[model samples]
Target: MGELQVEKHVKYILAVEKRKDDFESVVMEHLRLNGAYWGLTTLDILGKLDAVDQDEVISWVMQCQHEDDIAGLQNEDGSFSGDMWGEVDTRFSYIAICSLALMRQLDKIDVGNAVKYIVSCKNVDGGFGCTPGAESHAGQIFCCVGALAITGSLHHVDKDLLGWWLCERQVKSGGLNGRPEKLPDVCYSWWVLSSLILIDRVHWIDKEKLAKFILDCQDKERGGISDRPDDAVDVFHTYFGVAGLSLLEYPGLKPIDPAYALPVSVVSKVILGK
Candidate 1:
């Protein structure tokens, strides 16, 4: 079996960020904040976070948050928009909270309102959706669960029901799908698996099989992971793949917190001031 191309993967991530005019960067401009988090967290997990300029990253992150508009983003009903377009989603809630938490600026927003908005997205099936009344999806569920975890509002989650729904995402291929009838993908390995682990129900899934599935999706030559075997690789899937392995406690990789989605040491320093 081929091993993770640790050095090559790190170089690939750094290169992607530097190529601002590239197709991937252009396409991801709208969600640059989310991309930064993924890349930075991955670097941290690989023990190479120091490769980037810390002050520069923090400054760019603050600009993305737009401190002046923080209060305005919270709707009267508590939902948040990914941008000024006003399309509310639980995913934005997670992104906002996770980003702020990493920067140690969580106090800028109303935690109570944010948590309430996410709770409003919770469905009767014990899952969460992009917005109230929307159908639940694994991606949205991870966002909701992750946001709640960051805010210490996990009480809003129906652990048993959500856990059942999440574990059900695991398919015969040992890979997980985003929803019912969807094909299995490596990305869900992070989304569904992390949510399940957070609710203390990860034991319900086949960890060994899931690990193998993620490993099989890796590009042994180029050093990035794909959504599935023999597919093209990208930074997004690469982060998720490595993160999923971290969650599974794969040897030689850093351990990641299911909720915070950062290495335990980084989460501790950010949350605990250690």
Candidate 2:
């Protein structure tokens, strides 16, 4: 099944690479941390990282870093402001860090200042915000937690409060919401579940129901998951949908390392330099 998924991903990457779309163009220009992370992740899964210029790609990714000590930014502007808390988001920061780590350039980053920025994003509500002084969100919480875990600063987080906030994200349907009042979605299943896994609190959530809800979001005939029931299927949700289920130890899915946010299969190869 892993081999088949890799083949499917290779074909998908080929098709996407051939497209004359804005997605590819934007990724090249911005090297947006998330986009690069996704691209490299998929390629790594397919054992095709050599197809990309590792050095050039790493250089571009570093350029996206904000001099203001934030990890990812909406634009190259160093203004330290934006709609989502007027600063770089912790979510983007996690992706940026992961991307560099995948490329073995994690040492190039200012770990101390990056940790400071991530710490500042933590909200009193227990979850981390996209930026300082923003509302707590599940997605950003995953970012902050994932970042801290990767940087070996997990001890800095308030584990009790963070776990409480994550548990609060669960809804009757077993899906999770980014914020207090938003509707539950499959994406948060990844955010919240991953956070729980990192904090050793996975057993605290209803894994059975969460797995059912995530499966329900799948397009049975189409073979991909959507963000919500009846929504169009896309790559983003597809990846997280599988990942969310993987977290619950779903029978046929690969196990994802919550701390690094990568499938154990791929991470093993990375760590071993295989």
Candidate 3:
């Protein structure tokens, strides 16, 4: 029954922008990643991009060809590592593929093998995991499905099965949890909803109820969203909350491409060079 505090949310996001020379707060560093995804995507989606701090937006046209070490992250089996330290996960696959795709250099990596690696992480329960033989989870499903969608390889997913798995994440309160028997969290609205949308199964969930749930988690007066109502608000959950509302077709918000996790218009420019 609550409404999205659009102006308040925008102010909250802008209020948290990391000042120059700030390197101590881990929380600030997080929302600032990916050229301040929280600020850019939220501002862009909310039609408030004019309020963005241009210098805070780092549009890196990173070199990822063999010259830049994207290939080095790939293992023989095709999964990618988070970095030189070699920690592997479907999360890394999404990060690597999404990064390269935005750079217009997806071909620099082995697409066929990358798809194979992501597919291997799929479980019979119809959801994806962090690694092969790992437990299925909503966040992992988002990463794997997003990677597959970006690469034009979604056929590798079992849509019907995965859709059912994702559907079960919604609790009686209308909020979604990451996995079975877990408490619902605002973040899953982005994870589970985006994955369902990518597979053409978004309608299976209760849109109105989920939207109400997300709205209920917002700090309406101060402008930020939390994982649950009555909890502390942070930019991370605010990012997911606003992005989820966009996916739900909330009025006055722009559409975001579920796969790229960017405003749809921005994705066209980033990937298609439009």
Among the numbered candidates, top TM-score falls to 3
Worst 10 residues of 3 by lDDT: 56-65
Candidate 1 residues 1-274, lDDT tens each?
A: 3466788788878887898998878988987877888888888888888889999999998886454554467677767787788888888789788878888788888889889889988899899889888999999999999989888888889999999999999999789999899999999989999999888999999998888888888777667788999999887888999999899888788899888777998788877899
* Local accuracy of candidate 3 as per-residue lDDT tens digits, 136-218: 99999999999999989998898999999999999988999999999999999999999999999998999999999999999
Which parts of model 1 are misplaced by more than 4 Å?
21-24, 31-33, 53-67, 100-110
Clashing pairs in 3: none
lDDT of each: 0.86, 0.70, 0.87
Off by over 4 Å in 3: 18-31, 59-68
Error of 1 at 199 (Å): 0.7
Misplaced by over 4 Å in model 2 are 1-87
Q: State how far residue 123 of model 1 sits from its true place (Å).
A: 1.8
lDDT of 3: 0.87
For residue 249, model 2's alpha carbon misses the true position, in angstroms, by 1.2
